[model samples]
Target: MVTAFDEALTCLKDEKIRITPQRIAILEFLTEVQTHPTAEEVYQAIEKRFPGISVATVYNNLKRFTELGFLKEMNYASASSRYDFSLKPHYHVICESCGKVADFYYPKLDDVEVAAAQLTNYTVKSHRLEIYGICPNCQQVEGE
Candidate 1:
């Protein structure tokens, strides 16, 4: 089966981007993770596998990937931007306490976009919805 890593490599090849060991490791790491990670977090995770790898490399590749639409860059006012690998339409629920992000899908929101376009007579390209509250883990810790 063609995995997400394979597909990403194919896309990179089509774009004429050089495929290096570091790049491959980065792509594989991102594909396997559901947790939205910051550039620093990504660096910390992969640095063990690739000794001497610089954080700048991770940041640059992440920026390139985001520009190529391989992933989405989610920025929060309270913290550093996080990278999300999933491209499907969905909203996020953020943990205000720990800054964790989780995805949720609601098909009805698509209709809201259509209604908005109709009401304003303007083209709606996209939208973002973020619901913030303490996550379960944080709540448990608080209770304890």
Candidate 2:
């Protein structure tokens, strides 16, 4: 089976981008992580394995991956930019207390783009939906 990592490598190869161990480690880390981590978080997680890996290397690889459409870069005004590897159609629920992000699949929202284009007569290139609320963990902590 063609894994996501393999596909990512193929994309880089197609773009004539040189693949290195650091880049591979960065991609592997992103693939394994469920949370949307910032550039600093990614660097911290992988630095243990690659002692000499610089934060700039992580940031640059992430930026290149985002540019190549292998990953999505999520920027929030209140928090640092986070990276997501899932390319499937989904929305995010953000924890207002801890700034945690979780993905939820909602097929119905796919039609929103069509509806928006019809209603506004504007070309809708894409859309993002984020629901913010205190997560269950935070609520439990508050109850205690």
Candidate 3:
């Protein structure tokens, strides 16, 4: 059985990108974290293990991973951009109250893209959709 980690590593190998320490730690963090963190958060998590790794290193590796189709970059308004490694078809739900991000998958949206392409008679390469609302924790806190 091929795990997500295995698939990611395989992609790196296929892309001929060097498997450096920083890249390993970065990929590990992205594979382990579901929170979708910025490069700063990624650096903070791995800095103890990689004392010499810089935030710039994290950003550069992330950019390479994205270019190689191993991940996606999400820009949340004015905040530092976060990286997503879910590596599947889905959209994002952003919490307005606490700035949390979560994945949401809707298979029907695939057809929406086809419909759009037919209507415009133009090729639709891709799309991004983010739904913002108060998250459950925030709602519960306000209820209390």
Candidate 4:
């Protein structure tokens, strides 16, 4: 698996854009923390390691990576946006009680994508499916 850390290093010499230490730090943090953290979380974690790195730099680098198809931005009823490295089409299940997020994979979604493309005639580039509700742990806790 090509991690964002490795990707950052590999793209250093190959990417059309210039790479900075700040960018590398941001990518590495995102790659290491797979919880789909927000920009603030990433900034806070990386700032201690890369002193003087501003939150704006992290935000910009995230935007650049997403534009380059190296990362993805997701919003889940949170105050800030979340990011993910998964490039493939998959779904997400969010726990309403605790705000926990988990990935859901379904290979058969390709058929649905094709159907959406035909119906909209817009050439579906991508799609997102999020199922939101209380999770098992939360349900169990509430039951008790």
- Report the Cα lDDT for residue 7, model 2: 95
Local distance difference test, candidate 3: 0.87
After best superposition, candidate 4 residue 7: deviation in angstroms? 3.3
Q: Candidate 1 has what TM-score?
A: 0.95
lDDT of 1 by residue, 1-144 (tens): 977678788889999999999999889889988899999989998999999999999999999988888878999866699999888889999999999999999988889889989999989999999999999999999999
Q: Per-residue lDDT for 123 in model 3?
A: 95
Error of 4 at 46 (Å): 1.2
Which 10 residues in a row give candidate 1 its minimum summed lDDT?
2-11
Better of 3 and 4 by lDDT: 3
Worst 10 residues of 4 by lDDT: 4-13
Record all residue pairs in model 4 with backbone atoms less than 3 Å apart, i.e. clashing. none
Kindly indicate the candidate among 2 and 4 with the higher lDDT: 2
Q: Per-residue lDDT of 41-100 in model 2, one digit per residue for the tens?
A: 999999999999999989889999999998999987556898999988889998888888
lDDT of 3 by residue, 1-84 (tens): 987778878988887877887788888899999898888889999999999988889888888888888788898883788889
Give TM per candidate. 0.95, 0.94, 0.88, 0.79
Query: Model 1 clash pairs?
Result: none
Model 4 CA lDDT for position 1: 94
